[model samples]
Target: MSAAATTSQPRRPRSGNRRDEAARLAVLHAADDLLVEHGFGALTVEAIARRAGVAKQTIYRWWPSKVEILLDTLIEDSAKRIPVPADEPTAESVRGYLRGFARFLTRDPAGKVLLALLAEAQHDPDTARSLHERCLAPRRARERAMLTGATDAGEIAPTLGPDATMDALLGPIVYRALTGASIPRGLVDTLVDALLRPRAN
Candidate 1:
């Protein structure tokens, strides 16, 4: 998908007491656990509510559907696992980001959730819209900014457009994950070198 999709934040309940926050966390965790345990086809708002020990209405009050709950969980989990590093050289930063992303796809629980969502998106337009607007677009914006900074600093050649650059950098890792292929060691270094290495005069 192109990076032109508008960024939309995941929905959150209105500010509330600690009890509400607790219920919210409980629902998020419950959704995550259920998806991993039962897979997406079996996941339901009823199951999530039962697992969280909250009424179904509580979940509906905050999130319209199970997709929203999983989207929130994915966003929160990904933030913790793949934060962008600051104050590093552009190439190093790109390498680190790519490495962390590789691990996320290969090893993180949320990565499985992401894959499930991607699969769902193929047949469900709303899910596809939500996934792209809320998750993928924001991430693309961040990565594009980083690449733009590298270009401005003369650390990498700007031979590719922003969207193409993103596709080139991320497509291989994602394709490998989707196809169940193992990510070979040094692949991140290879991508960084190919995409971000400074051009010699």
Candidate 2:
């Protein structure tokens, strides 16, 4: 998951007329905490509202469903954690992204929530669509842009397309994460070196 640089500050709610930043944050944080504590199967708008000490109507005003709430939280957390550096070479930038991604998967609560979302998405079309549009697509676009730039500059092999390159770079880490396996150290370096082989002079 690639992201533009963002600070750790909480972003304001984007969909509602209410301007109470505190209430918005409380809802988001409550939803995240409840999801982590109770799992997605048990998480609901009522539970979130109850935990946040806000009315259920307030949550509905800001977000249509629990999924949207979680999606919002995921977007905010991912931006802060998995930033793509602007000044580095493509190889270094890719390496940094992969490293941060690995940590996010292993150490962040949002990552666990993502796994839950993925599971829910399998049986629910709405979830699948929302996840693809809101969370996955934009990150894929950024990653593809970076890879395309590297390909154009002849830093990466012309034969390897951006989509395939992304699959190769992110596939193993995601697999390990899903399977609950530990990511071995230097794995990011190995992936970068192997996949981002320089074009022959």
Candidate 3:
């Protein structure tokens, strides 16, 4: 056989993966819509599949449960809106990040869904663990690093513990959300100020 005749043909392009990703995003969008419209109690794998116009098996093949689907949707939505700030001065980073975080908690859809998750966690240990591990833990780790940076820069008190500072900065925001109280417009600034100001000896 001639050498040219023996050459292999170019491989065909694959658009199947793009279709799959689109379907996956559709499922997530459906889940997010359901959470906002019907709350977590109304979200189910079957319902999401129906809403997304995909087979139930499709959702099951990717996510194990309704909560897992919801968690993924929540995380994806959050990443788009509340990205971690770039490295900068500690005071600026802390204040800006917290302000954005607090604003997210007070708005529609995201705030409502998060509050629903918190409520769900209270009764379901598995859900609680998943939320903490998948959602909360990563953000907490970042916050810890930010606090350590702030301390290293002398933007806050040297004596302040990073863990304690995290609690101080976040506790109020969570508390207000859980309690149905308004997150004051100035609460972010207030918290930042309180965080940066050293306690009098």
Candidate 4:
């Protein structure tokens, strides 16, 4: 009833969300380890909780579904290791960065994991949308910015727009991964050559 009384009430102690956060993180980490060892098809919600040292109720309380857990795991792992530079003065640096991205995709579990997730995303609208927003767009934007800077600096031809340049540069890698084709012997060199080639226009 009084201001002092209200102040002394201490706001009724705001409930901490730490338990939810802990559960969510535990699920993601469990998903990563399970997916790496047993593949997506073999992973289960209960198995994840067992591996994570948490309860099944905790995972469900936070994620609602196994797919959501996998998506969160992918996002957390990718965020920590995407090799895009904090600073690069030219398109070449961008190209090198993308090559590193490819290396990450191809090495260890990250590559196979991403491919599986991408395939799953194709059938799930929510997953697809989140993948595009959280993964593809930011990486593409970084590459585009670097290329645009290089073009402005006369390192690359001015006719090359961001999207087209990115396609010319990255399309090959995507083709390789998606189709299971070998990375062309001179992948980066070939892309750079195509990128730096004079536009007939």
Candidate 5:
């Protein structure tokens, strides 16, 4: 067969198949709603399938476990909620970006899902690794880039570094989420100020 013919050979049935794709999205939406309504410990593959109106085997065919399903949802929602900031001065961009991130945590389903996943990870090392790889890593990389830009522009002190700066900004947000505390008014501004505070000469 010609190379074009060989390359264009019928694609095998896979996750992208229309019916399966619909089922997959249904499963993800079901997982998101269930995670929010019932918390992580109570979530089950059977419950998700029942809610999605798909056979349990359908979920198993696409995702190995509930964690993977939730992770996919988190990734999708975060990407939609937290966009990369436009070209701008480092400080302004970082401030806008972090503010958006804070909003995502407080205002989106992804935030609740992430908190549940983090809690689950504390008891399961495998879950921790998967969460790190599937969700945290990409998000952190974006954070790092923002910090790196700020540092390059002399907006961040050399001593604090990106990792430390990220922790400082996220620590309170995570704490509030864990404790169910509201994100206080102007908290994002406060976080940005703390992160970008001037260092003594």
Candidate 6:
């Protein structure tokens, strides 16, 4: 097209996806700074905006509330992705992968953010659904594959339920996190061992 013709054409609007993503990142960074300085109880949206140097309306334009911004911040700051395994999926490999993931959550900055987000998720259904879609479901499916694969390999009882096994494996880590107990690494190892180790029937 001629430069004249190009100039005459109506300009397309900025990409909403890119703009929204930039806005989201800004809010998340703001939230992270506030959280580190003041902790969860005092990390308000107004505080986040002040730190981000954006107006509160700008933050709200991308996120509905302070909790939503915090959830996204946790996810972005996490070193690992939803399907968190670090290697190919043998049952043993999968067990090892998840243990490493759990340990990271306990020891890393992102882990603290995830714990904070989980506490918020208890009272917020929107955050709960987003967490399920963004984090929980993908990891659940990966673990499910490892559990169900054992049956196909004739290692586990085909009669056994994959869903039940997944619940058995995941339930304890979450339980310990919620219950305010010091979880032994041994407990997680035990759960993995019971689920993935070959059982003689």
| Candidate number of the best lDDT | 1
* Alpha carbon lDDT at 199, candidate 2: 42
User: Between 1 and 3, whose lDDT is larger?
Assistant: 1
* Predicted structure with the largest TM-score when compared to the true one: 1
RMSD versus native structure for model 4 = 6.9
- Candidate 2 TM-score to native: 0.84
Candidate 4 local lDDT, residue 79: 66
List the candidate 1 regions with Cα displacement exceeding 4 Å.
1-10, 86-89, 198-201
Cα RMSDs, all models:
6.3, 7.0, 7.7, 6.9, 4.7, 6.5
Backbone clash pairs in model 2 (N, Cα, C under 3 Å; residues 3+ apart or in different chains), count: 0
For residues 1-201, could you state the per-residue lDDT of candidate 2 as single tens digits? 112221112333443435566788888899889988999989999999999999987677667788888998899888888865544346666677889899988889988778788889989999999999999888988888877776666656634687888888888988898889998868887888887885456
Better of 1 and 2 by TM-score: 1
TM-score, cand. 3 vs. native: 0.84
Tens-digit lDDT track of model 1 for 1-201: 222221121356545568878988999999988898899999999999999999997687778889999999999999899975545347677778888898898898788789889989999999999999999999888778888777777667756886798798889998898888999868877877776674667
lDDT of 1: 0.83
How much does candidate 1 score in TM-score?
A: 0.88
Computed on alpha carbons, the lDDT of every model, listed in order, comes to 0.83, 0.80, 0.76, 0.68, 0.78, 0.65
Give candidate 5's TM-score.
0.86
User: Which ten residues in a row are the worst by lDDT in model 2?
Assistant: 1-10
Candidate 5 local lDDT, residue 119 = 88
**Clashes in predicted model 4:** 0
Query: Of models 1 and 4, which has the larger lDDT?
Result: 1
Estimate the TM-score of every prediction.
0.88, 0.84, 0.84, 0.73, 0.86, 0.71
Model 3: pairs clashing at backbone N, Cα or C within 3 Å: none
Q: Write the per-residue lDDT of candidate 5 for residues 1-201, one digit (tens) a residue.
A: 564553343222243459866877888899999988998989999999999999987677667789988998988888888865534447767777777777777778878898888888999998899999978887887777777766777766545777788888888878787788887758878877766866486
Those runs of model 5 whose alpha carbons end farther than 4 Å from true positions after fitting are 1-15, 84-89, 154-158, 199-201
Clashing pairs in 1: none
**Candidate 4 per-residue lDDT over residues 32-150, each given as its tens digit:** 77887897789898999998888876566556567767666666676677655545346566667667666656664556567767777888888688768866788678767777677
